[model samples]
Target: MLRAYQFRLYPNKEQQSYFANYFGSVRFIYNQMLADKIDHYKKTGKMLKNTPAQYKEEFLFLKDVDSLALANAQLNLEKAYKNFFREKSVGFPKFKTKHKSKASYTTNNQSGNIRIEDGKIKLPKIGFVTIKQHRDFDGVIKSCTISMNKAGKYFISILVEQETPEWLPAEHKIGIDLGLSDFAITTNDSDESVKYANPKCLDRSEKKIKKAQRALSRKQKRSKNQEKARLVLAKK
Candidate 1:
């Protein structure tokens, strides 16, 4: 089984600058690949064959960031293009914009180059960063994704692969149906059925949630109070 554990990161000023560069580099590589792939498809009805290595020569600053992050960006762009052609449900890959895109990058773990040591987690290029591991995980670490939220909070999501015992299939199958009226209804092979009531968590708090949001909307945009109110609404 593959599990993910997330921990809050407390990086110093220099580390924060490095993170900013990494995020920008990954975004740039992704956007560049997407654009080139689109143009390639238009010209030859095929995906582009560009790699991140080619960009390093032109954009020397890319060398400052984690190379694996840029490689992952290339892989992500390729997957997106593949999905667009192979699956009709998804649209063509879009260019990433620094302003609206998720500020994150991914790096792989090889020979334990990345790990938690001496109360800090090591990342490629950047040294150990202080991490708050609220919960402990004992699985083998596979990769890590570093992300920064809109509120400027940094987090590291560690993907871990663990071996789990295989489970035997149930002798009987159950059918499940969900609805707003009832949270869920289940029927077994014997035609026995049971219905679960809706928790009505939000339904019960609708008025309060609406009032808080209304108050939030009235606050000055981009103000500290507005930010706090936004957090309150999100919690609801």
Candidate 2:
């Protein structure tokens, strides 16, 4: 069985710079390979086979980042192509833009290159980074994806492989009916129904979110204040 656990990341200045490089490098490689594939298809009427290794000589900076990250970018391009061919509804892959694209990169664990110890996570190319591990997990590390949100918060989701637990026989069964006013109405074998009230999470925070959004709208576009307001709104 495979499971994924996500934790907040706190990287220092150097590590943050490395993360920026990794994210940019992955996006660059993916877009470059995609463009080449399209041009090759247009000229030769055949698919082009390309790898990050072929571009290493031309782009020396690529060598500074994790090799696995580049490889995963290639895999992502391949998957995009496959999806387009398999389903017409799934459009062709588009180039990633710095402003609009997601800031993230994925890398696989090799020889224990990725691990958690002493309240930190070890990553390839980057040294141990502080992590807020809310809970502990037991499994072999498989791969991890590092991402940064619009609010400038960084997070890592670690994928793991583990054995499936044995299931125990059920002694009773219940039927649950979902609703808007009530969260759920569950009835057991005894025909006794219990209603759970809706928490109304959005209703509680709606005013704060709206106020932040209005503040964001009043700021000048592309200005530092606007960016700050956007982050505040995101947090809200």
Candidate 3:
């Protein structure tokens, strides 16, 4: 079965910059190919097939990123077109805009191009970067996808193929029935029932939260005081 392990990444300033560059390059390739296909269909009434290799001459800057990433972007674009035609419910592929889209790029790990060792991961174009592998896993690494969230946090998800045992229904399973008053009513395999009370932490923190929210409303937008109030409210 396919499994994925996500780990938080800690890259140096230069490496983070490189990550942005890669994300932009991959996004550019995807958008460019999609736009080309649309234009071709409109004019010639036929789909124009543009591969990643065909884009290199026009977009020399794209060479800065890992070639595999660009190829995958094209693959993803083609898949989108296929899905749109095959599945009547799906919509057409849309263009990707920088800053508006999530920053990410995926690279294959064929022939051990990508590897993890000693709390570090070796990625294409980017050297060894620090990571927090909190959990241990066993399997053959298949691919690695690097991504950054809007919060300025970076992460890497490693896809792995493992020899997993077939799943079987548990003999001693428990089913929980949710309730409005109680947290839940759990019925175990033995047919014994247990009731759990709801933890009303919200009732305790309601007053402080309301105070912070009020203070936040009074502060002017884009002002330092407002920013501070927001941080305070977030902490609460």
Clashing residue pairs in all predictions, respectively, total 0, 0, 0
Instruction: Give lDDT tens digits, candidate 1, residues 1-236.
Output: 99999999999999999999999999998988778777888999876799998888899998787788999999998888889789968987888887679999999998998999877999988989999988877878999999998667899999999888599989999999998889999999999999999996777699778988898999998899998887787566
CA lDDT of every candidate: 0.89, 0.95, 0.90
Considering every candidate listed, which one attains the maximal TM-score? 2
lDDT by residue (tens digit), candidate 3, 1-236: 89999999999999999998999999999998899899999999887888988988888998787999999999999999989889968999989988578799999987877888899999977989999999998888999899997557899999999998899987688999999899999998889999999888987698888999999999999899987898788667
Return the lDDT, model 3, position 180: 86
- How much is 26 displaced in model 3, in angstroms? 0.7
RMSD (CA, angstroms), candidate 3: 3.7
Angstrom error at residue 148, model 3: 0.8
Clashing pairs in 2: none
Ranking according to TM-score, highest score first: 2, 3, 1
TM-score of each: 0.75, 0.93, 0.82
Q: Residue 26 in model 2: shift from native, Å?
A: 0.5
- Predictions: Cα RMSD each: 4.8, 1.6, 3.7
